[model samples]
Target: MIWNLGSINADNFYDLPHLPGPGETLTATRFRQGLGGKGANMSVAAARAGARVMHIGATGADGRWAAQRLFEYGVDIPHVAEVDSATGHANIHIDPQGENSIVIFAGANADIDEQMIGAALSEARPGDTLLLQNETSGQVYAAKTAKALGLRLIYAAAPFSAAAVAAILEDIDILVLNAVEAGQLHAATGRELDALPVGDVIVTLGSDGCKWISNTARTTRLFPAFPVVPVDTTGAGDTFTGYLASALDRSLPMPQAITLASRAGALMVTRRGTADVIPDLREVQDHDFG
Candidate 1:
């Protein structure tokens, strides 16, 4: 089982000729909406990847649909709460080149508290997996609680927060980061990425592929990116992390899990949108990585 403490967002997408410049107003060529949020994305991905996922989050009246959407995607959401604040949301502007610019509003996503976290975690047993991201509050409490309960913790350091990562570093078993965030974390801690004390540090290098530094073995391995043309790169990292977590939870070897995750992520970029586009296990299993 995977317990995800994360944000839920309504993703508003606008297709544009190019990203807007400073103070420039441009009309979108197309528009659509869907469920999103780094936390939400990971939970959906893990669920679709065949893990049982429990989502711990909050949504306002207007964002009730987001929670419902998560339920529809196979994530268990009994712990999701209805709060007073509006639901979180993101405005994603995509270009023909598949690049994007985004702005986020954190609403009920910031409403997570210890009560909600404690209650949700009470249902967990030892050795269950806990997934966390920076988009929501109570990460410190969640990390500590999960550790005390003997759950394995996988932390995806995105929208990276130095202080948050620093606060829970000792509790993390695996750390996931993309290239830029890895560099930022390196600068923040004044330590190389390989020097982190976590058992596994996975650095995603975009099209160049990802590298895994294993502290236990004192060795590193590389997994090359599968060949594919991207239409929109959104949610790829979340998909990778979610699938990776699910694979590990199933007792797959680390190298096999990373490779399977690479395939899922490569397929993710080939589609447009956010959580809606995360490929299910069957799709990934049937995909041609060539």
Candidate 2:
């Protein structure tokens, strides 16, 4: 089982010819609304990849529909609570090149408390996986609780907060970050990727692929990305992280897990939309990359 203590957001997407500059106003070529948030995206990805995933977070009255969508995607949501605040949301602007810029409102996502974290984690057993991101509150508490409970804790250090990473670093078994985030972490900690104390560290290099460093083995390996022209790169990283965790939970070797995740992420970028667009396990298996 995978327990995701993450955020749920209503994603608003705008297709644009190019990203707008500061103080610039441009009309969108297209607009669409869907479910999003790193947490929600990862949960859906994991579930679709054949893992039993339970999403633990809070949503406002307005966000119930988003939570319902998670259920439709086969993610367990028994611990998602209702809060008084508005649901979190993101405004994503995608340029013709598939590059994106986002503005996020961390509304009810910020309402997660220690009590909620504890309650959700209490349902998890030893050997279960706990996945986290920087979007929601109570992450530090969740890390500590999951560590104490003997769960395999995985942290995706995105939106790259030095302080948040420092706080939870010692507790996480695996740490995943993108190229930009890896640079930020190196700057913050004054150490390179291999020097991080975590057992495993993965640096995702979007089109070039990903690198995996095993701290315990003192070795590094690179996995190249599948070539494709992306339609919208919105949730590609989340898809990778989710699929990686799901593969690991199923007892696949690290190399195999990374390969499967890479395939999933590559497929994700070829499509549009967020959580709804992640590829299923069968689609991944049946894909002919030749």
Candidate 3:
């Protein structure tokens, strides 16, 4: 089982001709709302990829539907608490090319606390998988607790925070990052990707591919991305992370797991929306990377 301590968001998408510049006003071409949040997306993605996923987080009463949506997507949400704050939401603006800019309002996602985390971790056993991202609070506490419990911890450093990474770096087993985020971390820590004190580090390069650096093996290898025309790049990384976590949880070798994850990410960019659109394991396996 995979335990995910993450945020749930109502993603509000606005279709624009181009990303709006500062102080610029432009009419939107279209609009839609869907389930999203770095944590929620990964949870759905991991669950869809065949892992028994348990999502631990808080949502507001107004956002009850999002939690229900997660349950419908195959994630176990018995630990998801309904808090007093409003549910979190994201304002996402997308261009014709599927490039996006987003602003987030962290409401109940920020209300997560030690008690919630402790209660959730108590339900997990040793060797269970734990997935975390920067969208929610109590990550450090959760990471440390999960580590002590002998869980295999995977961290998706979206909305990357160097301080947060530093606080829990020792507890993480796998670290996932985008190209830009990887650079930011390197610059902040003054260490190369392979030098980071973690078991494995994954740097995802959009379209080009991803790099896997293993500290234990002292090796770094590149896994090429599958070629596909992209419509919405949003959540592609989350799809990759979630699928990778699922593959890892199943004990697939790194190369095979990355191949599966690459296929999922390739498929993800071909669609729009976030958690709602993550492909299932069968879809990923059946997808022709060619």
Candidate 4:
């Protein structure tokens, strides 16, 4: 199983022709609701990519229904918990340029505890992969426990929290980040990207593609994408991370895993919502890498 410990939320999206400037409010072109949250979106993405993904997250009364959404994408929910508090949610505003601003209510997400990790870890075994991003509490706890249990741990250093990155870097098996995040780590030390000590680091460069660096290996590559006029890009990053996890579970090498992941990321750009955008494996196989 590919275990994901993170947040779950129902996304409320407002579509506007353009982003609103400061002190300016524009009428929205459209709006809709979808199942999202980096955790949930990636959970679905991993599942769709053929990994048996189990999401460990907290939900509230009204938001309990949101957990069912993951089932639709074939993600396992044996670890999903529903508490008495209100569920967390995101109010997302997306412009035609595919950029977005999100206001989050971290209700149930902020309330996660170590007990949740303990419960989830009870069923895990060695060789399973535990994937984590910065969406919940107990990341270090999860990493340490997964390592102790002989499970491989993959970390996506996102949301750029300095304290959190410092807290969890040593325990990660593979460290993944974007260019800005890679710059953040490099700037703090005034060293080269490869100087940072980690098993592996992936710096995703959007259209320029992603670079993979390790102590023994370093290379950059691009994935094939369709000639897409992106409509929304809210979940592209999550898709990449999720697909990468799926590929890794299949024992694909780093290069092949990233190629598949990049294709998945590109496919996500052609859609409107995070949950609604993930493409299946067959679509990626037939996709032109031009």
lDDT of 3 by residue, 1-290 (tens): 89999999998889999999989999999988899899999999999999999999999999999999999999999989999999999988989987889898999999999999999899899989999999999999999999999999999888989899889888999999999999889888898888788999999999999999999999899998899999889899999999999998888988898889999999999997788889999999998877
lDDT, residue 194, candidate 2: 86
TM-score of each: 0.94, 0.93, 0.93, 0.89
- Put down candidate 1 lDDT per residue, 119-144, tens digits, no spaces: 99999999899999999999999999
Go through the candidates in order and give each one's C-alpha lDDT.
Answer: 0.93, 0.94, 0.92, 0.82
Higher-scoring candidate on lDDT, 1 or 4: 1
Looking at model 2, which ten-residue stretch has the lowest summed lDDT?
226-235
| RMSD of every prediction | 2.0, 2.2, 2.2, 2.8
Give the per-residue lDDT digits (tens) of candidate 2, residues 72-111: 9999989999999999999989999878898999999999
Query: Which TM-score value belongs to model 1?
Result: 0.94
TM-score of model 4 (CA atoms): 0.89
Runs of candidate 1 exceeding 4 Å displacement: 15-30, 93-101
Model 2 / residue 219 / CA error / Å: 0.4
Error of 1 at 199 (Å): 0.6
Kindly provide the TM-score of model 3 when superposed on the true structure, using C-alpha atoms: 0.93
Deviation from native of the Cα of residue 184 in model 3, angstroms = 0.4
